[model samples]
Target chain A: MNNYSTFGTALHRLAILCYVLFALFPLFWLLKVSVTPNDLLYSEGVRMWPSRMSFEHFRFVLAHSAFPVFFRNSMIVAGATAVIVTLLASLSGYALSRFTFRGKYWLVALMLLTQMFPLVMLVAPIFKMLSPLGLTNSLTGLVVVYTAFNIPFATFLMQSFFDGIPKELEEAAKIDGATQFMAFRQIVLPLTLPGIAATLGFVFTAAWSELLFALMLISGNSAATFPVGLLTFVSKFSVDFGQMMAAGVLALIPACLFFLFIQRYLVQGLTAGAVKG
Target chain B: MVFDATAGFPESRRRSLVDRITRHAEPYLYTAPALILIVTIMLAPLVLGLSYAFRDVHLLNPFSGGYVGLDHFRTLYDDDNFYRALRNTLWWTGASVLLQFVFGLILALLLDRPFAGRAIAQALVFLPWAVPTFLTGLNWAWLFNPVIGPLPHWLYALGLMNEPANILSNPQLAMWGPIIANVWWGIPFFAITLLAALQAIPRDLYEAAAIDGAGAFRRFTSITLPFLAPTIAITVLLRTVWISNFADLIIVMTSGGPADRTQIVASYIFTQAFRALDFGYASAIALVLLVLLLAYSMLIVMLRQVLMDRA
Candidate 1:
């Protein structure tokens, strides 16, 4: 029995190690190629690590290429979308948590319907709609679209967080002459800081990673998001694997940071939601 | 005191009426901004997109946008690529979901066991879900490139290939590239959800079962599977719909390449609209996909209802 248990433990650990390596290997490769010197890239074929590394790719991508602009544009759009979506989602989520009102059911159903359909269907029509208003090729346009796209999911996320808080806190404030909105803003909002952060991070990552809409809406390098810019660069300069990987590495940074920040809350938040759901 | 209270009651009654009106409008007030945005941005475009399927709308053609009922759908019916794409969608969604669910379940079960450094292990294993989809596509594509990537060489050494050639260019093997990338990216979603569900299964059940001389496998089969069934059902259903629509990996890696072998319906629609500039045809394809997804969802919901009723 002791030997059997020891064997089981070893198997479990080995399984875990395999999963970790599989998860990290591609990312490891991305980093490795990005830092490898151009002179050694072809010569060091299939190496786990280059004999020597340099910052040349990163420097070229930063100074000579249009990646910095794309990065800045992505940061602005994602930041704005995160802020806007979180704010709207918080209010609506609070309402969903606290109130039983007309249209609440329909509102949720509509949001779920949005999730079920292909957003690609909206690509052409949205372009037509925005083109007339001169919203195409603009970061503001991307932010608006991303905010709308993210609101439904973020609202549900925020609602789950709000549901975890006791209703009595807001009810107590309400009885003490606070309006419902006032109670929400002053009492409830501050309590759900973790949820707010998670939603912000979630929306930020999503907006940062969005590809198709960014590709369709933005025409030029000046307004392109990271994904679109990288893709365009991939096609335009197919030879510069090192430079492209460096850009790819840069794109991974903010998302990984946000993921690390919110992953704990992500599981916790979902568990609460799932149990309640 | 009675006279003073009577006088204040009328004033308070009027104030209370105003408060009642405000209370009734409060939720709507809170939801209005989000609702308005959804309507204008998502809902309205969806309706317009449906209409676009019936009209002849071309991006570069000034003479287009005329009503041409059933024209695009008629064309879609005869388009060989559309049928091929439909077939590919099934294979792609099935293979990706199956692998992700299986691996995710295993990982979740593994992580459920408490051990030293479990927290860090959990974080590391779940890290892939954070990589952006486009980057996931690019990273995997690069990994399959024969010149820079080691995969071809490794496969050759293992006698799985004739030589160190890029699989992305091989029609028979190209779909695997995107599917592999997708599986790697998607496993965390299932693991996170399943792990949560696993954790929710009462620990006392396992203890009680063990006390009754039930083995580990027996306890899992009797306790864990049943507890996880509902979560598993819903997550799998939702993920099926989501993954069918996910074309980023395919689009980035192969662009439905070699011979359009990887052209799933979602990517096919994208190609039509983006590359061919045929919005009408794209919307028509999208409409078909939408109906199919709705039917799948409806079927799942009805099945769940039937299962619940039986229970």
Candidate 2:
């Protein structure tokens, strides 16, 4: 037998098992609900697995509905916002992390102050501001709004990443006759890939799931995102659990795929190789 | 294009111009995009919100409005729903943050041990963090369904609940349903941050404690807990600030329903601006939330100062 306390170790293992199961059970249920035949939803009553499985809802959502358009719209908005914000954040973050400039402290304080206000307060004014410019119902408008909202946090995220990198490498590149921008692009940019990936994934997910602004700005289904589309399952009278959960399950795929694609970089602490201890 | 003019200009003026450009060039180049976007998109709306808050603003009354000078705030203060929303928001921000920190601390400590399959276990624990907030809210809403939910069904099977009760339909339980969901979603962040800090602790500390004959509980108190304190405090602050602004969860789960029972500041503001179309009053309530967040941030700064002094 092992010298370690069997009872304590077993208890620990049991606790971990319980927590993992608890955390994962919802996703399992989502998959389960999505597969359950619509007729058996109420009659079968909380069964872990459905007696019969069907892909009818997914078929209906994909082919016979506007969900595909909504899906495409979400992808466009998320992709554009992520790319734009990351590009903006990387430069600003590098400056914040490396440079000592005039009014640097005040600029940082101003950014922090912007974050303090509730976003809801800004909605009406934002709408008022956007409507006049013919931007209320456009994908570009959504991207603009998301880029604005995500930039501060992304900048901070990128700043921390930049801080993790040593300044000596850039100095070395400068001494070798490269300009600042050249050094940043050639050396620092490659090292900051992990941070950029994380920021892109973060901003993408945020824009994808955002409902409030999308709801407020877009009136028609043309510009409506998946979150707003999910609301269509809710009529005034009765909530359609089958279609809603089905849509919910479908909406998770892009996010899942995005994470799966970027998960490698996300898990790797890339700053480790950028600087020597 | 202006080479001849540059020669005609004073030498000192020319030198200063070059100096200015060189001195300011890099930071200006780097910060230009962010500053332009932030000023136009963020700052303009902020100023516009403040001005809209003071006017008798409505959706139909786009910009042509009369000044109301705290009238909206007064109406807001008198409204019972506002107070309820404030109370519920306070409970949400405070309770969720504290409970999440506690559970995360416990989980992190357990996982910090040398064990097989620890990485897989950590990933599973972090699954909730990756799920979208709306989806998480929907999942919890289903889990608390009265007739056909696993949780209530299991509770009934275990002889815990009287009936397969709709927890979200209940005023007392509905508020907590979202809070519980938030805590579950938020725990992974705290766990990850704390685990990183825990891994940085020197093994010598534990060995020294064992040499002094300190048992597991004693070691936890004397070594682990103290070392983890600063990280715990900072992570808690971050989670609190994030959770206080949480609208997606509340909006999807309840829509502040069952008699405005679960309304928090953020969701309340959403409804006021969107549902009621009362922009002025909504902006006032949002300003209230802004003030609250500012105060909490000040507290975080103070906490950081204290932690630095202790270090």
- Model 1, residue B294: what's the lDDT? 84
The numbered model that scores best in DockQ is: 1
DockQ-based CAPRI category assigned to the predicted complex of candidate 2 = medium
What Cα-based lDDT does every candidate model obtain? 0.93, 0.82
Candidate 2: give its CA RMSD in angstroms.
Answer: 3.3
lDDT of 2 by residue, A89-195 (tens): 99999999989998778778767767766677778888888988999999889999999888888998899888888999999998998878888999999998978
What TM-score does candidate 2 get on C-alpha atoms?
A: 0.92
Q: Against the true structure, whose lDDT is highest?
A: 1
